[model samples]
Target chain A: MKVILVGFGVIGKGVVKVIDKKKNHLKSKYGLDLKIVAICDRSGAAIDENGLDLKTALKVKEETGKISNYPEKGKNMSIVDVIKTVDADAIVEATPTNIETGEPAKTHMIEAFKNGKHVITANKGPLALYFNELTSYAEKYNKIFRYEASVGGAMPIINLAKETLAGNEITEIKGILNGTTNYILTKMEKEKLDFDTVLKEAQELGIAETNPHQDISGLDTAAKIVILANSIMNKNVSIKDVKLEGITRITPEALTMANKSGYTIKLIGEVSENKLEVGPKLIPIDDPMNVKGSLNVAMLNTDLAKEVVVVGRGAGDIETSSAILSDIISVYLRTKNE
Target chain B: MKNNKKQKYNNFNKTLYYYGENMITLDLELKDIPGELIRALTPISNMGVNIFSVIHLREKKTDGRVPVRVVISDAGNRLNEVINKLEEMDIIITKVNETTRKTDIDIVVVGHVVDTDVRDTIDRLNKYGLVVDLDLSMPDPFKESSARMKVIIETDKLDDLCKELDKISEEKNLLFIKSF
Candidate 1:
């Protein structure tokens, strides 16, 4: 399979590293030989019709901070240009998310489909804002679109519901979708620290971003839930449809009070038949939903299966790349016979 | 005639009502004094009802009252009599079987809990549910204070109570973190 990586940030670099690491395994286990035809970043794109060397790609990206600096295969070409002209079977759209507009990534995906290429993206922006539009394009061009990494990174949720638990009628989906907020809340409850104190400590420890508005303000979780609502639950919803509440107001005293009643506070994002909301909810201390630390957990309420809970690391370079790689292989297996 | 009546009562006691019989679960709030639990259970015992399991929620005690779940065999169609007897003894029956007569909800309010007319806040919430337990923590008067309250309300009125909390939140600039 020939693939084009659309972004060269942490996740993009991680994808290159993973594909290199699993080259032999992918070939031996599934008889699948994967190749990266191009890697795009803000600096430009590096193209190789005969498959770019994975090691040199990572080295150039690390040393020069750009894939366009690759020895002779690199060029100053836009992402759209690469999508339109590159001879590749699929495009792995791992661009940075723009929740407000879903731009750039949105354009990249639409162009990928229009140019007769399949898309396997981990971008949440376009999915949250333009799911129907983007999906319509994919169907119009008859390309397979897979995005298991968008929701719970490395935690099989979208595919788990749509594939493994396909026959069950899923009634509700709820869990802690964001890891940064979970870390802050878990630390606060454990040490009885205020939100500001704990958040600063998390930022220093790199668990939280310097500007942690989206994760802390529930926007990130809202975006992910919107994707699940649209794709898994078959609900036509967007980011604005979520009734959001952040954890800024939570105090140590509040956690103590909740503990008094055998409960703990978590920023739970819940989507059901009559509800779509994200806020601080009281989870029973011993419940499965009460996973500590930066781990993410989700519970799917289905008619036949009753209830299914999934827990995993919601973020990381290689962790997220693991999910992206699965999608790549899935696209391969499904289209291999064709 | 008195001997016959005594013999019938004795027979009712001897008949063991085990599984598959009509079982009634009573959710009661009892005073934390000695023999309070027995005082709440003695009425049904005298009515010839077989007792099953008593789950005492000791950790959920608030305001000197412990919540206990008492399951008993409702033999002889005496559910109403058991309820009346317990109520007559001043035992607060919060729920019976699957029907919730009343339920306890906890809310942690953050803000100037005392300055923003906390009395009116509680009074407004009291319209939908009774504020049974309140624990206030005021780190500094100039800063925001936190208050934890336990409200016992009818299950049907939970939505109304939440709406009222939202209204109070908007009106007084307070954040009500509720346990749903």
Candidate 2:
């Protein structure tokens, strides 16, 4: 599998590690030649055309915290330059989520499809923002666009909604789609931590970003729900349409009192009855609604059945990277040229 | 005639409540033992509270416990009554949370060693401070036939429920399933 990775952040780095780890098994067993030919960060880009040295690149990342100073073996280029010019099977679009306009990643996804390249991404903003248009473009260009990691971290929710429940009409979809918010809420309830306390702890735990409004304010979940709604319904939806809520308003006293009251706090995103809203609400102690810590996400009220809830580790380097690999493998299978 | 009208109005002394309002559904968990579900629910039902829907599916865990999902009418201050009833019943509840419909939250109080004393968990939720809103029954036969229930209460009480559930679960050999 030949590929190019964009934005070598934590998740992107994880993907590279997995590919490196499995390269031997894939080659010896399946005759697969996994190659990450190019890597690009905002500062600079490196292209080996053959393949970048994964070991040196990783060491460089560990040392400098960036994918620079690796002796620049390949043709050094810009991210846009690499995306436009690279000859790879797919683009791993793991850029920083630009929620405002969904710019570069969105544009880059289009470019990849137009240029006959498939896409596998963990960027939620672009998918949530342009699900309809992009899916249409994929169809137009005969490309594959897959984003399982965008929501539920590593949970196979996208597949659950699209493939498993394809037979059902899927009248409703709901879950605690954000790990950061759920972690904060859990800390607040368990350690008696407040939102800010839990939130800061989340940052220390590497579960949240420095400016985590997207995760804390429920915007991340809103984007995820919008993506699910659009994917299931196959329509173009806007974030504005989904009701939004954040954990910032919650207090320690409230969580403590909620304990006194027998309720758990979770930031939820729901879409059903032709409407979607996102916010924190009190869930019962045993409804499978109050999944705690970083493990969460559930789907209820499907078309063919009553309620089916799926749970697992919602976030992890391995899990998220595996999702991206799934996207890549899917693209490889679809365009295998066999 | 005017004196008669004034007297009639005074005699009525009735409180008016508006209808057609959306009710938030809350999910709750308690002991699956005997008399627990009724103890958790009767207090609220007698207070004129309406239930929207109840989903009771025994978790199918070998531990012999139950899980219930429920919806209720979210009218006026009915939340307070529901919370009081669950606390009274020692049942732990989370706000009945849904999306694209209404803003609600989901909570749970998991039980372990449920095979022996099914009602022990729910009984604890009914005691004090912890709020509850709904109660349900599991459908499976030959499994003590525990009830599945959903309840809604305030968000602030979540930690207290976890602490209490942890404490109870520790002593009772209960499987404190965390809320999703």
Candidate 3:
């Protein structure tokens, strides 16, 4: 199976590593000759009728962190050119989201589906911004459209909630979905470190980007929860559906007061009974969510289960990419079965 | 890094797999008592199919009952055998995923794969220039003694990483799942 890749960022590169590593395993396990045949980004796109060399591609991505130089490395063609040309079996849309406009990536995904290719994504902005329209096109085309890596990175919460918990109606879903806010909150609680110190550490660690408002203010969590809401609940929800709050102005006094009262603060994403909301809250000490530092993520208070907390390294090229691989394996398994 | 190292793998080769198929969920409406879920899951565990995911609880306070959803992964031929056993045990079969695909993948890494030697590991990754996104650490409640010591790689690693770990596993007591 030929795979066209988009958004050759950290997660995209991770997908390349695991896919290259497990190429044979995937083939033997699922009868899939999975090949990443194309890639697209803001700068440019790369496509090859023959399989793309993932290792070399990662080097180019690192050297310039852009897809502009792939043809410079003497590949066949540009990524967008391939999206228009390649008869790929699957499309991996990993492009960065322009939340304001939901551009380029969204256009690329629709084109893939229109051309009858399966679509998988790590981009949330488009989906969060326009899930209803895109999903309808996917269903209309009868293609496999999955986004496991979008919300929780590596946690199998989306699949677990969708397929595993398909029996009972999903009554509620909640978690410390954003690592940036959780990092700051965890630092405030443990070492008397203020939000500023934690934010600095997070940026250095890549958990929080340089401009971390989306992650810090809980908008990221809100966006993610709305997506999960639609997937698990099979309903349409928008940004307005999500009530958002940021931890921007949280004071040490507030943190100290929460600590004094035996509570810890966290930016939590929550969805229940079709009512979706996300924000920072003071969770009690006894809450199963006393999860501190960077390792905090959980699906809480399901009518069918109290909580299925999957805690781990939330970010990393490989770790988040692990979710992509899991989805790829799933797509391979499904595709091969046909 | 897709490193195919000079290491051996004692892997479970050539296991006949059933194509996409539904795994049964033995849903039960039991009282929200102390040992309800454990009683259900423990028996299923004994029966052999790996529990992929499980959930059970009573939502409505008005009605005191629990709904359980258990997703399992296993080969067929034994599929009927497992279902028969669950039925014999009076396990109420609930929702079933008609045709689900489960990948044969597990993550096993050196427990302290990046402990004191964080820089070395980062350097290794940097060779491939794989961006490390979300590698921040949490405060260990039990922050024990430290050395540049590598702990056992037990649970999960990318397939290529598995081959590399197999080479150094013997020297480092890497508790990898499938290393020769």
Candidate closest to the true structure, highest lDDT: 1
Error (Å) of candidate 2 at residue B12 is 54
Give one digit per residue, the lDDT tens place, for model 1 in A1-338: 99999999989998999999999999999999999999999999999988899999999999999899999999999999999999999999999999999989999999999999999989999999999999999999999898889998998899999999999999999999999999999999999999999999999999999999999999999999999999999999999999888999999988887888678999999999988999888788888999999999999999999999999999999999999999999999999999
lDDT tens per residue, model 3, A114-144? 8888888888888888888888889898888
Winning model by DockQ: 1
Please give, for residues B123-150, the per-residue lDDT of candidate 1 as tens digits.
9999998898888989888988888888
Interface RMSD of 1: 1.9
What tens digits encode model 2's per-residue C-alpha lDDT throughout A185-255?
88887876656667777788788889887888788888888998898766567898886657776655445
The clash numbers for all candidates, in the given order, read 0, 79, 20
lDDT minimum window of 10 residues, candidate 1 chain B: B13-22
Backbone-clash count (model 3) = 20
The residue ranges of model 1 lying beyond 4 angstroms of the native Cα positions read B1-18, B29-31, B43-67, B75-95, B99-101
lDDT of 2 by residue, B1-180 (tens): 999998877656431221134546565664578876666667767877777667665652112334455666664666777776676665655444642211123333222234546466667664523233433233334322222233333455554665676577568644332333
Better of 1 and 2 by DockQ: 1
Best-to-worst ranking by DockQ = 1, 2, 3
**Model 1 clashing residue pairs (backbone):** none
